[model samples]
Target: MSININSKLDSQNSFWDINLEGELDVSTADKLKEYLHGLVEQEVVDMKINLSSLEYIDSTGLGVMIGVLKKLRTNDKEIYIINPKSNVKKIFTITGLDKIFKVEG
Candidate 1:
């Protein structure tokens, strides 16, 4: 399955909420990287990625997220990941990424 990213700015909270669906694998990792990098470049302070609808993810996808978090940290920004499915959550936990990034319910 292909990955799809839908995003919108929350004016009231001044944060960008990104909803990701479908699969996040090697092929789509670059797309995610570019999109997230653009947001960081634009000086977005807070980012919330909703992964509840995401059906699958690979190491590349996780790397893309980590790269984004690193970029944000450089700019003193923060990234929050929300509602990851159990399988996906396991990957984060195994990789110790759960401690590196904020995961919300």
Candidate 2:
């Protein structure tokens, strides 16, 4: 299934809370990237990506996340992923992204 990404901004913390669902393949990665780009343009300070509903993610999705992390770091912002699925967590673990990005419970 195609991926669905929805985002909400937290006024108190200046954080973007994103909810991602469905499959994050090559076709859907661009939407995720664009959402993050918009957040960057606003100079957001923190991000909390909720991945509990996400079903699947491939390398393209991983690349998009890595790119976002790099951009956020350049701006001195922090990004955290919440409740990643086991399969997706495995991918992050294999890529060593679990070390780079903050994975929250």
lDDT: which candidate is best? 1
**Backbone clashes, each candidate:** 0, 0
Candidate 1 lDDT, tens digit per residue, 1-105?
Answer: 588899888879888899999989999999999988887777567899999999888999999998888878886878898999999888888989899889887
| Model 1: CA > 4 A from native | none
TM-score of each: 0.93, 0.93
Q: Model 1 — which ten-residue stretch has the worst lDDT? A: 37-46
| Candidate 1 residue-wise lDDT at 86 | 96
Per-model root-mean-square deviation over C-alphas: 1.1, 1.1
In candidate 2, which residue ranges exceed 4 Å CA deviation?
A: none
lDDT of 2: 0.87
Clash pairs, model 2 backbone: none
For model 1, the local distance difference test gives: 0.88
